[model samples]
Target: MLIVGLTGGIGTGKSTVSKVLRDAGFPVVDADVVAREVVEPGTHTLEKIKLTFGPDIIKNGALDRHKLGDIVFSNNTELARLNAIMQPVINSAMVDKIAFWRAQKVPVLIIDVPLLFERGYENNDYIDKVVVVTTSPQVQLERVKARDNLDETKAQNRINSQMPLADKIARADYLLDNNGDISFLEEQIKNLMTELKGIAPKYGTK
Candidate 1:
């Protein structure tokens, strides 16, 4: 299987690309989805998080994601602490998913991780390529504000919390520019899928 890492900043339309892949029958293991699963109520991960971030972050026997986001998004130290607690479990889950897909002999596997480079997944031996989706800063900021219902400053803070889009683009083996309409973005993804199809067959032979 060809292991491809798909990543982008907060509002660069990475989710749209992942959806496109999914609709086209590609299996995408989204880190954000796995992250939520690992921290579900009664899980050890959630217990550790409650202890670390305090019990207030939990409500109705579940982790209050908004409360936790507010605490960490404005503070880098708190964010790092949260990541330290979450990354290991999330990574393990993602690895298990990948193993399952590989065993099924899927031609291509896309891991939609927001922080692929930040967490060093790009350097993993199994990752065959990195695709970074990006758009202009203005477009990204607007999208973030509208999608998250945040003011400009808060939206910018969310964007600032991640590795910059430029840095991610610099490291990309494939780049999808999402500055235009959905049709344009879809076209780019279609081209990328075509290329990946050609490369997938020979991915592990070497």
Candidate 2:
């Protein structure tokens, strides 16, 4: 299978791009969703999180993501500690899901991992292409604030935490700009999809 790793900075319409790819018949393996799944009620990840961050991180029998985010964001040591505890589990689960897609002989699999570059896992041999969604900083801030219901400062902080859009573009094999309306973004994705179809088979299509 051709694994396309799609990523974007906070609020760059990465999800929208992923939706476009899915609508175009590509199977998307969402890392964020799988991360949550691995930490659900009975999972070992949840237990480890509870033990590491304590019962306070849980609310009404479910992990309070906001509370945990607050803790990690406040302290770099805490954030690194949390990543250490969670990343391995998330990565393993993602690999397993991708393996299933490969077994099914899917032509294209989009792994929507927001931190693909930041996590330093961008060039995995399994990944055939890296597509980064791009947008201006102003647009990114505006979109993220509106979508996440976050204030300017908070949204900026989140944006600051990720790799810059410029670096992502430099590293990507393909770029989809989402600085405009939905229709424009959709068109860009369509072009990229057509481009991928031509490239994948040459790389020894699975």
What range of 10 consecutive residues in model 2 has the weakest lDDT sum? 197-206
Best TM-score among the predictions, by candidate number? 1
Native RMSD of candidate 1 (Å): 1.0
Regions more than 4 Å wrong, model 1: 204-206
Tens-place lDDT per residue, model 1, 54-104, is 999999999999899888999999999999999999989998999999888
Looking at candidate 2, what is the lDDT of residue 6? 94
In candidate 1, which residue pairs get closer than 3 Å at backbone N, Cα or C atoms, i.e. clash?
Answer: none
lDDT score of residue 16 within candidate 1: 98
**What's the TM for model 2?**
0.95
TM-score between model 1 and native:
0.98
Q: Scored by Cα lDDT, where does model 2 land?
A: 0.86
